[model samples]
Target: MNFALGFKTTMGESGSMEALEKQLICPICLEMFTKPVVILPCQHNLCRKCASDVFQASNPLWQTRGSTTVSTGGRFRCPSCRHEVVLDRHGVFGLQRNLLVENIIDIYKQESKRPLQPKAEQQQLMCEEHEEEKINIYCLTCETPTCSMCKVFGAHKNCEVAPLQTIYNRQKTELGDGIAILVAGNDRVQAVISQMEDVCRTIEVRITEVHLPKAQL
Candidate 1:
């Protein structure tokens, strides 16, 4: 009975992790989302590079169809939903990065590296330089975790350090703000594309109206 329960628990954990990894896969690359993942107006996600490639591939529309819809930029259909995405002069650079997804990927990688250990056998990280001291602070200059002893009287004496929790909080706040700003920027870009498309449609109608009177004669 005990063996069966343990086996089921392990299997459940593995399944959840696999499911999450599947969610992060990029449709264009058929791989996990890389850095600078961007969310389309359609709420679909793609790597920025892959999005740029798709947008570039779509440039032929402007030349072949002479699509006057967007004079300055281009558009592409979303792979997941077939929704169209129009860009500005900045192209993919104007796309909002899905930083939340990126943070999840980073966390997944870090968690994967750590092996599960039984509570009784869990180990503490000790400083290599001060073998007797536990690594309790992070060195800002060297970007390493070190022991208290290192800060006061060791090689890291000249370096600055911070509590690990403080660094974690600061980074979290910064990323949160970035994600919010990017999301807003994305909405505005979409709005601009939509407005340009409308303008093009109106121009086409006016041209047709002028030609219609001549055709009647």
Candidate 2:
């Protein structure tokens, strides 16, 4: 799927919104990420559940159906970059959640939920090739937005096409799930920031106390 989000002004072609959307999809499930999305050591993100599955599959004991279970500290390769990832005692739970990705997902969901005005829809519905035609079809093969004329006579004439509405609905659902994941990530980041701020405050106070004694002397 062209996971790109497009922006059209009733008369303009969609921008790179579709491209941005694609980045949020999990390679393992081929869907938008779920809650507790983990950033692997290689910097690739995966849904926590998907990471757990990969970790289990990599274990010889798990594959043989042996009664012995490996500790969460086992290692697994990243599904995307194939980088080796060593988990902590909590396994995938020990991996850092990507707050930035989660925040973008939340913003996208909010924007998606907003009803587009008739004027805005008209501005965003036009095709780049057929300026007069609204984008009514999605080219499944090429993963591009197309006007009816494009389907009949343009480059996508021989390609598989689906109604734009269907794709739109599906993308909306994916965005909704993304929002949930982002919320959890945001909380995790906030906690860390808070802890770091407290540590900094303590160090500042200690430094001030040490300096005060020297100045008094």
Candidate 3:
């Protein structure tokens, strides 16, 4: 049986969104897998960013200026099973994307947006790939929130994604700390500016004193 078919069969029997969502989580981040999820030789999935971070940790000398673009090939162990994943010169970018998981994430997000209702109000959603069959499992979106603005138009049209979990929180926290550092530096700059203004004032006073009229020729 095909991998997707087998999974779908299991999903049908389990009929639990919570259980399905649990599998979508990345082991390293412990959050839902973000875009461009990669599959290791061990068959475990990871977000590309997480994979790059792990790869860099394993090969710090190859890390560039905060980007995953690597100059040489290296290897990193899968966080799930510790299976070594060898990379080419392209680094994590060279890894094959798990498109099946990406598609599943899209479906998961769509299901998350719809409100739960009685069977009478419930509408069946058919998968684009498997149009003949209604989407497996019942909708249990009451616990999840939906955003109307996400699908409207403009820049947010393609803005659909699982709520920022692992990467976003970490980046935001790092950003908050960075803001504090910038604020402290700005305080030093303001003090320097005040001192410069004081020097100008003293220079003006010295010039006035030198210009004072004297009895001597």
Candidate 3, 1-217: lDDT as tens digits? 7764554445542246678889899888899999999998899999999998999899887755566554678998888888888888778888999998998888776665655434544565554434454433221233222333322432234444344244457669999999999999999999999999999999998888788888531
Candidate 2 on 49-155: residue-level lDDT in tens? Answer: 99989987886443322543345367888889788888765666678998868766776665556564454535567888999998998999999889899999999
Candidate 3 global TM-score: 0.46
TM-score of 2: 0.45
Flag regions of model 1 displaced more than 4 Å: 1-12, 60-71, 116-217
The Cα local distance difference test for each model comes to: 0.81, 0.78, 0.72
Of the candidates shown, which would achieve the greatest lDDT relative to the real structure?
1
Q: For every model shown, what is its TM-score relative to the native structure? A: 0.44, 0.45, 0.46
Better of 1 and 3 by lDDT: 1
Per-residue error for 86 in candidate 1, Å, reads 1.1
For model 3, the stretches where C-alpha displacement exceeds 4 angstroms are 1-15, 64-71, 119-217
